[model samples]
Target chain A: MAISEPIVLPHATDEVRLARTWAQPRGFWGWFMNVHHTAIGVRFMVTSFIFFLLGGVLAAMIRLQLSRPENHAIGPDLYNQIFTIHGSTMIFLFAVPMMFQGFGVYVVPLICGTRNIAFPRLNAFSYYIYVVGGLLLWVGLFLKTGADAGWFAYTPLSGPQFTPGKRSDFWAQMITFTEVSALGVAICLATTILRQRAPGMTLNRMPIILWEKLVLSFMVIFAMPAVMVVSSMLLMDRTINTQFFNPANGGDVLLYQHLFWFFGHPEVYIIFLPGAAIVSTLVPVFARRHIFGHLAIVTSVVATGFLGFGVWVHHMFATGIPQMSASFFTAATLMIVLPTAVQFYCWIATIWNGRLQMKLPMLWVFGFFFVFLIGGLSGVMLASVPVDWQVHDTFFVVAHFHYVLIGGALFPMFAGLYYWVPKITGRMMNDLLGKVHFWLFFIGFNMTFFTMHFLGLRGMPRRVYTYPPEMHWGGLNMLASVGALFMAAGLIVFIVNFFQSKARGTLAGPNPWAAGSLEWATSSPPPDYNFTELFTVNGREPLWDNAPNQPIVSGVRDDIPEVLITNSLDSEPQHKDEMPGASIWPFLTSITVSIAFIWSIFSPWGIAYGAIPVVITLIGWLWPRGHSPAPRQPALEGRWSK
Target chain B: MAELEHTVRKGEAPALIWWCMFGGPFAWACDLGFSYVLEQHTCSTGHHYVLHVITVVCAIIALTGLAAGMAAYKRVPEEANDHGVRPMDRTHFQILFGMVFSIAFTIVIIAEAVPRWILHPCQ
Candidate 1:
């Protein structure tokens, strides 16, 4: 085959074949060392889903134990472990990894019209570290010491004097592992979104999903640090008796709350924004039109990111703070709702005007609107200092967040799965089964969480394993427990539908849903290099435009996995960035980091000695490859300061 | 709306963006955080009035700096390319993103000072 010229290259199918030959890894060890965004993305989805199931099972156990008054279904000690693990696993392992890392990795490159994510090895390292982090938590659980001080891991309760042993250490270490993973990917994504977008896919013309992701990536950059600080502080206090949280040593408990909520509050947006992105991506496709308020939505997403940081204190309102301090948070929290409301209204406006095609994905969008709205309203109620005083630690708070997490994250997740699984697996999910899954899950979800609001309002405290029959709370608790069963049944239906559809569902070609995004402009489960010929996107929906096959972005060297680095605003091609080929270094580095984290749990000195392998592995990893041209200095100026 | 931009030195756009992203939030955090620190320090050290006046001045300065940055960010044009790197493409929206929060931060700082004005320091 002839090397085609940059301007008029065609024959995408031929290029696909050539790209595959160079891009695809071979067997066994090759798969482990693969750095392709798609491969790593699929792994993230799989791992997070497995963790989701594990977390769900723990949830079911909790509900089962609490179903009957004075039930001995599970002891309090084990129950504490279960609840803590469930929250930690779902938030850290399932929600953030699955939403931000998995979805962002898979779609951002394709949408940006790049061959692979920037820093591909770092991407792989993030995944491996996440896997290790998740596994360590579950392993600790099996040993019956899975961070029993709650997901927040609040002080004094989680302080050295009260909780001993490796339980809290595991929680802190697991957090370090996951956060390092999240932060690494945040950098990868920020670089990719900022630099690798195709020519003409300018800032304003870029899709809403990309904007949401850019903001979320930056959020991960800034927000994840606070948690790491708190977690490490807690670990130091426990292991070395630093007394960061101990009142006797001048460290304040509220300081922990301040730091934790600083990260914890944005953590909610970190998880929720991706779900909103999925909805933004799908709403136009399902509604049969371009979105309403495209610019407004983009601004709002970024605005939400900015405002999200200020409202952390709202979560700490229950702690005794001055009225004036609480009011500041209250105002910040209230202000954030405007941007969110803009997003919801824009979606509603788009769908109302669009030629509505209520497919499986759209159904979940509707579900998201309903459930997240309730959660949002409850959140508003909680934002008020006085209302939060009553329901801060109650099941009402439980009801609110489930509405947020399940409705906000999971509902959109399933929608995105239905929307993208075909582009992933080349098969449409079963429509009938999808509907059954949605309805069952939706009904069961409402039944389970909504009842908790009443149970909480009726004076039932949270984190308790059992309640007395005389409390008259058995009825609501029982109802809530039964609702969990329905949700489980619904989930089972989904699992069957998902698996069955993968092998037997109807075939989906390049654009099954007639979506306008760039991802669908190629084969259903696009080839190893994603696009055969990258497009110079002229508008938000390039495929929706009248051009029959848009112009291609050439000049990327196919032999070496080259990608075009473009200007952020106009997406004008800057230069070619060579994507690193698959290597075992990232995997090795993950092990090095994991060993450091695990050892630090027992002795702080492990971090120092651990730095040896880490530094060695990092040297090997960052060492410039032998293939590239040496850096060209201006003229012959080898000496510093000519 | 027309996409507007201004020419920048080679690497200044990213710095501008970094400021645009964090300036407002940091301002608000400082106000909130300083208030927490000042509230404790003043109450303990018996200088509540001085602490209150000091926080108000610092917040005003931070607010002005954030405001000035937002103005510069808004002026970044879509066509502004430092060499071939066009970090200014989304500068307007990013400015708006940060500006809204800057306003919110102004509110937060003002809000943070409310207790310093109305309430007794520690007793």
Candidate 2:
């Protein structure tokens, strides 16, 4: 077991050994047992995309029902359920999972030059939990027990007294499921970024996307707890006779508002920052240069994270808080604009300084700029208490958030998918099809959301099942519905291109985009081992800066799932650690947890009964096998001996 | 044992750097949370002045963080413009980022305070 200097093997033999050692189990049971980050990441993306389509169908139904004044296309009761599930699915199931969890899980470890994500089994467990959570909500919808109390599920309305049944209960427990999943992935991503970076990839050399993801993980840690707590309290009040939101029991309704918004405001950043990270990542590669003002962009991201938490009160402005409180929130909301503007300026400067290539991915970036800018401008107006008071609960407010969420998260998400699909699938998507997808989406998105501003200004209220013909809202609503059709068409084209490219598109080499990050340094559709020889970088754009002869880190055993752990700041290698391989316990544990969560809606004793199996499954998941390899001696004697 | 020596040789980030990086945000968070909670008291007791005092104290604390960042920056001035992967470059980046964050949060604190001066607490 004496540590010897790593001897280089023939490339062919090294590939074979690495492949053999890192191979996943085969067939059906193996799929459930898989814990590789890339596999789990793909599962997250595919599952969330299915939820996205389901959510889209719900949106289209809402549009059809409202296409004409007093349209009776959908009954009011079902309409209530449709809109509620639509909002919840889009925000909770699709956006966060796709933007933050899916992309983060897939790309972060690769970009950091690690063998696998830290806590790979937990990553796998998170994917299953997310799937089950999504199924619970959609199943409830199909079963006619869907949550009808809107996405936020504000108390009194969602309480047992007003909207009885298990509808709101389903919503509360779904939040618990997704939050638990999100928190798990957050810990995995944050730890991978902080401790498992390639040796010498110091903080200064870290990519902008890594910085953004790190900040995002921290935001998730701080913000998600508030939502989980409030949701649990809502459930307690409904099932267990607690009075957290019961005004007659001396429980203030405003308490729910305060707690929910604390998580809710930062949740916007939780979704948007990952989108911003995509833009930051794409700009440098397309512009063909190192990003301008790298430190400033990183600083702006951190500032945005902090400022985001302070502005939640603005969402509560029309609820009649004191003028001083309103003023503080208004100012905080306005202040958040500065950091986002700084990021925008840096992106523009980077493009200005370098030769801009309008690749397909870059085209989606342009779309994001147009759509997100309009959304952001409208948001500044909404920040003012007077303007918000006028537009409160109007179609105008509806228009504002759609512009923000769709433009900010969805647009950048499509950009990232286009940019990384080659690396994930080892094939290039059809360029003509991608362009068509972009134009239809861009045009249709503007047609649908921009018209809502007018409808809102005309006094059309949101969440109402129908409007009278005299309201004069028919023409605009019709136009918006037509736009939804076009957006739907664009999504169809994207789906066709995605699968078609995977099977028959041009074979993509390791660096299809000729990008500069570490992920590009490895093969497209990277091998299970990630890299035959781990990389050691000297600069941010390692491929471009170190080029042709970038240093390779050797000595981490190719026989076991060993990853090099490094110091946090400097990334100086410290010791080697083993990573867990594929297992079925994560899958089993998720089922146990899901059964408990779903059962609790019916009986209070479900939790008490559920904890036993959960504990047993968790024990199985955590139990260590009695096997240990002899420790290797230090490779570099002087460095190890101090 | 040898790996332990290697880890020891890597050293640790100075506490001043962590304080400089995070202290300003911690203060701003305190200002927001406390100000929000204290609003109920201010409205009931007619003591609007308490909010202004809290804002002033929080702003001062944020300013101290800015000063600490500046002090750290001055020590690594040679690496200020460098974005290399050296140890000094990493320190320089952290110091610069902390300074920018401190300045940004300080501005936010002051802007938040302005609303307190112009409007009555209970209005």
Candidate 3:
């Protein structure tokens, strides 16, 4: 089929007008109303990092208390709250937000070659709720009333009879806020990936990162409901005198575990898959080759998400369920390794076959390999019923997951940051500082977590603040504390690198890495509308194949907030969809919802009255504002500078 | 805003994709629930045969759901979710997706059911 001739350019005046129309307005109100996905994505990143550092501080305190036998940096009572908030902060605030919600919202539209996300207002709404959720948890901690029921908040002990306080209530509601945020982004991403591909770019042609993201969106959708249900049940039991986990009232304690781990197990993949997607994305770029087994990798990722649901029972192995049921969980848990192994091998194969470039990103990939392998192998041992029985609540399990999460999520996250920092910040990060950060981090991480398996094997359990001198665990505890300090040093190095590079780093033009995806097609940091003109994607590596004169897609109106939607399988141009512009309604709506949730802690009837304001705000957000012409450049464009 | 009137939903994905994505979890949940209920029933009133029958029935039901998912996969277009620009690409990506899940679910459902076959209920 013959391609249509390119649409004629509308000249400099139109471009300036388009830029002004899409530009976020100035002042504090504009900050609240900004719905641009890139800006929102950056907010998610910056806010989540603050939480990560705060969580790290809590961790350092835990390390201090546990440094030696009979150490008294803090008491067991205080220890419980610190550790609970530490886990809660990292998982809810840092991991999901930084990995899936932040990075996905930022990159998904750019990769799909669209101007905005599917639900821009909802995207912004999720961010505000996330911020409030973080504030609520931390504010309670500052007042010396943080949650102490462990991150999972197991029942009966956490019930009103055993422990009565607002701590558990705060924890439960925080889950409400964050998971609602996650679920909102999940719908946005899934719809965007499914319906928003550029013309001529179909499923086969999409980068592997998008595939992992698509799978993650589905996992978030299906897995999050289990957690939402369990958390609500916990809240209800405590506040409303319900009997969801009250054993004396015919409620089963095990019911909570079943539901929590049902979501808990898949949550691993939810966070980890995006990291793997990052690896798949950068490996081929640095290796100077197309990724090997693209379809197989996608299949493996989808398989991981599917099989993730089947294996939740494995986490409950120590409860002494029926032997037959235990065996089934054992099988599913062990079987999950095959797909992951396939992915690892595919990465290695791609590197082995291509011209390897030993860049900073590649250095982290190597780090990911070494660290994740240790985590994965330890996990395999725990998958066994007998072994898990021996080490179920020990530091061994703790060591295994730390390796998994840090190696799986954090390492690749840095790699993505370094690789794309230029594109996002318009400047290359300091290469020497990046290398220093990586080596320091890798050594410190292993030193901290690796010794833990032995401590656990030596009979040191987790969640205990101090130990008897006769236990002989003090030396290793001291070593782990030293390791934590080293990792903190590495983080400080990264922090210095981030800000310094942003302000004074080398300038990076578009496509700094000479990579293939569509994101690299625009200017450094991109324009307000992202693309001056969209390109037709006819192959997987459009940059490599059609660099000089990639076909320009036109007919999209410049004056309004509009994006192209395409057919799912073939990316056939279907229609233009209008995006919601800047609004304070999403922000107002989130406040209304947060009020309902927090008020429900005091009274369940809060939902009844809360419905009114929330409904009104949502209508305000969605009501059609008739299209107005794009704002013209001020008659005196330079007058704003004065 | 008028442009949204022209927006279209993608064609329906093959049924197998839905089954594979959701069927296995549903089957596992059913296996867990029914077996737990059966245990409480039998432990209360000792009818060993009824326990055995319940175990077999749940396994059969789980396995049948998976088999039906496989049967659905057989009829799906070869390119269900693929990015191919041909008629054959109708749902290539979706089909491959369902196919992968179908195999995984079969393994999981079978693995899940294996415990039912081997271990005695209420043990």
Question: Clashing pairs in model 3?
Answer: B79-B91, B79-B92, B80-B91, B80-B92, B81-B91, B81-B92, B81-B93, B81-B94, B82-B92, B82-B93
List, for all models, the DockQ compared with the true complex.
Answer: 0.23, 0.51, 0.32
- Best prediction by DockQ: 2
Query: What residue runs in model 1 are displaced by over 4 Å at the alpha carbon?
Result: A1-17, A629-642, B1-31, B40-123
In model 2, which runs have C-alpha deviations exceeding 4 angstroms? Answer: A1-13, A629-642, B1-12, B77-82
Specify the CAPRI tier of model 2: medium
What is the C-alpha lDDT profile of model 1 across A537-571, one tens digit per residue?
A: 64678788625554565545565666667666656
* Model 1 docking grade: incorrect
**lDDT of each candidate versus the true structure:** 0.82, 0.87, 0.80
Between which residue pairs do clashes occur in model 2? none
- What is the C-alpha lDDT profile of model 3 across A148-259, one tens digit per residue? 9899988877778866988888888899899989999988888888888776576677788888888899899888888889989999999888998987889999999999
lDDT of 2 by residue, A1-642 (tens): 111123232222266778887887779999999999999898898889999999999999999999999899899999999999999999999999999999999999999998899999999999999989998999999999999999999888999899888999999999999999999999999999999998667887789899999999999999999999999999999999999999899898888998999999999999899999999999999999989999888988998888888999899998988888888889989999998999999999999999999999999998988899999999999999999999999999999999999988999999999999999999999999999999999999899999999999999999999999998999999999999999999999999999999999899999998898889988889999888878777678878877465456666676777787877887877667788878999999999999898888888889999988999999999998744642533433344211
**Residue B34 in candidate 3, Cα distance off native in Å:** 6.1
Candidate with the greatest lDDT versus the true structure: 2
| Model 1: DockQ vs. true structure | 0.23
Please state the Cα-based DockQ of model 3 relative to the true two-chain complex: 0.32
Q: Worst lDDT window (10 residues) for model 3 chain A?
A: A633-642
Give the CAPRI rating of model 3: acceptable
TM-score of each: 0.89, 0.96, 0.90
Predictions ranked by TM-score, top down?
2, 3, 1
Q: Could you tell me the lDDT of residue A466 within candidate 3?
A: 93
